[model samples]
Target chain A: MADRSASITSQFTGAGLGRSSLIFWALVGGLALLGGLLGDSYVRHIFILVFIWCIVIASWDLILGYAGIFNYAQLVFFAFGAYGSAMLSIYAGLTPLLAIGAAALVGAGIGVLVAVPSLRLKGEYVALFTFAVHLALPPLIQQGRAIGMGGNTGLLGIPWLNLFGFQVSSIDKLTWYWVSLAFGAVCVYLIYFVILRGRMGLAFIAMRDAETFAQAIGVNEYKYKLLAFVVSAVFTAVAGGIYAHYTSVVTPKVLGTEFFLMAMVMLAIGGMGRFPGAIAGVFTVVIGNELLRSFDDYRLLLLGVAVVVTVIFFPEGVAGAFKPKPPEKAE
Target chain B: MSLENVTIQFGPFRALTDLSFQIERGEILGVAGPNGAGKSTLMNVCTGGLHASRGRVLFNGKDVTGFKRHSRCGLGIAQTFQIPTLLSSVTVGENLLAGQMFGSEARGSAPDIPIQDILYLTQLEDTLNLPASQADLLTRKRIMLGAALATGPEIIFMDEPLGGLNAEEIVEFLQVIRHVREELGITIVMVEHKTRALAEIADRILIINFGEFVMLDRPEVVLNDDHVVEIYLGKKHDA
Candidate 1:
């Protein structure tokens, strides 16, 4: 009890310049230095992917882990952001950066639309409904060619991200890497501070752990659930927007089954619902995905083995393993 | 607070049948019933966790039968579960803070009762930072009560607040409940199996069986009622 108390207290109060936070900032700085020093575009590119996916995973964690909502449509929101931003840039004549922000608003709207009906459902049903959305999205996007979605071939030649009059190009991978890093950092902090550390965080956790109790104590479940979806959707779409501009392409592949499965694996290994775990999960999976390029056909098999081993060793994911198991059901 | 002909039906099954009762202001109303007698159901209906299939719930003479649970909470209805349900992920302090922050009319305003007062009343002053999931049953129960009180509720519905405690723990817990009423002046409707504890703390006792009202009166009178006895043990005067 004492140990668990210490950990929770630290989680609540550790926003200051504590040791762990200092170490975290140092690591971020170290990675930035590495990006600057390494002339290898490949390594720098992997770091960029890591940064982008970190936002995705962290946003996913807010709803799935913190709110304990079984929302399977996170990737769909990402796809929406990708497509929405791309269309806004290509057809609507908006800058990539401004398009990303507008796309997030659209994502928030979609989040509200989805959460109002879906979040009222029981757990497994919510998962099924959202998963159905995930399955339905690609075909819908393909059929959306009349609206300049580019259909099967997807949207290409999307403008490069222009920052303050300077075009950030693919050739200057380092600039793209730093831009993504800064973007990811800002998004993660928004999630961490606005939801996880604010009053809503407590409300979300209460709603997750004990719905009836939370409601009876005046924590409006639907309100908080909707808030969770909107916040999650906003950042996830931003990540997707970044992904679109970073790659200069928007494709149906973003909504692929493999991408969803990879996300689940990252959440599993890094510990779903654990703060900072999602970030770790993103790094481990993205870097591991890049590292195992040589394995070819056997790569997925090895990744499966890694998941099994991680589950066996760290039942709570890598982050949870470091913390003590909560005392036997408070009976 | 009052319920008029509240009936809850789960498809073909009726959990509560035309249950009507009035809870006076500033009184501990002890509710007793056999297992599955709809005691908890009655609590649920009053607290807006469940909407009665038929009938009305009037809080302060306002028709709140259709209000959601949190809305009712904002109207000063708070509750503790039979099993001390808490946000296991957060600390005890956080749990109470959740109540004080959102449970009252305070919403974003100042809470009426300070969290420190609730901590001291619940005898959980020392373990404020402790994770609620790791606390013992006694502490959990106290935290549950504290969380309920933190809402600054006008009326609190407690389901089996003292269900699993030993004699000493029960004695200590009963004192807190008394403090809740005497010191805080909050109305309480407690569903408890322990009649003795209820008799000690409650101003009036209401008994039910098989979703039907059995008796409602002072502790001595209701406890001695033949129907209450039959529901508790067996037939009072068996053939």
Candidate 2:
């Protein structure tokens, strides 16, 4: 029943941005720009890898953290982006940029496809259905060898991202790192500013905390859940498409349960719903994996211990560890 | 709005039976009953949360027996809960804003009532930025009521609006309820255990026992009835 003006204000001019928050993003942007000078492509590759994971993790936060829905299909959507883009560029001879865009659309389509059927389910049911899709997809793709996906080996030699003939390739990791950083920052800004600050954001939290009350007051649970999933999927797919271009390959491993667990662990360790925490989790897990590489097979073992310790000590995630200060003068 | 010979059954148990009543426009109707007396089930039927096994519900001269919860809300029927149902993590302002769009588009191009007026009517003008969880019980109750009001409903169903409040808080809430009637002219179906306070504001009170109407009359008559006094109020005016 809101008038046109309230809707306009809520959508466009979100709760005013605080000075501290603005400063925080500025600092983050400065640090991302400095990542270009991180020396060897080895270091820059890890940095670029963190940005790739950041997109996925932030999207997960949108559904899991803010909406408080435990969705397991995010990884599959991420892999969809990569695979869709890979197939388009390799099979259809489409331009790399156009392929990535197509992949994002494909991701959104799948997101709605899964979310619509599962919106009636809550908690574990959502997990079961989404996980079922995630687990059932890789094998389906693997069996599609005739479709040029290369079966178990996956599609290799996917072209790099080329903008007007400038190749953003893995050999020059700095360029890849910058591209991912820009995309990741955009995802974070959109999810945090537009979705979270709008009326839909309030509906999401309302539905989460008290569903019956939410319904009685007019919040549509199915619509909000679908919105969360679709928003999460579209971005996750774009990230995956870029990831395929960066790695120059698309594989089943990207859709594996293990990869989902890794991303979940990163999100949890950093803070399940917090934006900054998702980014922090990516760096900690990615860099920790890189640094512990000398231990070879034991790296995962050590990383597991660290994650368990974090869960034990800070179950809320690194972002959750910091409590919000009580409102000044009680508003 | 009226219910015609309604009956609600769950398995073998009849939660409500052979119930019928009419609500006058802009009237405040109070429902009183002991525990498990189906006081809530009656409210549930009107708000479209539960369906009567038999009967028709008429709202604004239309038979609404088949309407779902949201559809009923869209037609200007809204409700609050027994427990406080504020969105604890969000600000009071956001919570109020969330209630603005439900069933609203059904009204075509009619603009919604302003948010500031709701805040003022509910006496929450200064609490616009406070998280709902931080508010005290009385404020929480007001916020929930205001949220329902923001939906632009012509009628509001309140279940146990006075639960857990002290004598002072109860009096304050009654004032708000009275203000709601005087200012908004919104018809209300208030289900409560607070008989003494409820009697003053309610123009008519409906008493039910075992899902059957004991009496539906003026507050003074119903409160003074022998069976009502025996079952609900006992000897004293307090419940």
Which candidate number would show the highest TM-score if scored against the true structure? 1
- Predicted structure 2: lDDT: 0.82
Task: Assess every candidate by TM-score.
Answer: 0.94, 0.90
Q: Each candidate's DockQ score against the native complex? A: 0.50, 0.42
Model 2, which residues run further than 4 Å from truth?
Answer: A1-13, A18-25, A295-298, A327-331, B101-112, B229-239
Give the CAPRI class of candidate 2.
acceptable
Candidate 2, position A225, lDDT = 85
State each model's CA lDDT, in order.
0.86, 0.82
- lDDT (tens digit, per residue) of candidate 2 on A213-234: 7877776677788988998999
Model 1 C-alpha lDDT per residue in residues A194-243, reported as the tens digit of each score:
56877778778888899888888888888889999999999999999999
Shift of residue A30 alpha carbon in model 2, Å: 1.4
- Report the Cα interface RMSD of each model, rounded to 1 decimal: 6.9, 4.6
Return the lDDT, model 2, position B216: 90
| lDDT accuracy of residue A142 in candidate 2 | 81
Tell me the lDDT of candidate 1: 0.86
B1-239: candidate 2 lDDT, tens digit per residue: 89999999999999999999899999999999888999999988998889889998999999988876766777888899889967887777667766775546433323255665676678887777787888988899999998888888899999989999999998888888888778788899899898887888899999999999788999999988888878854666656
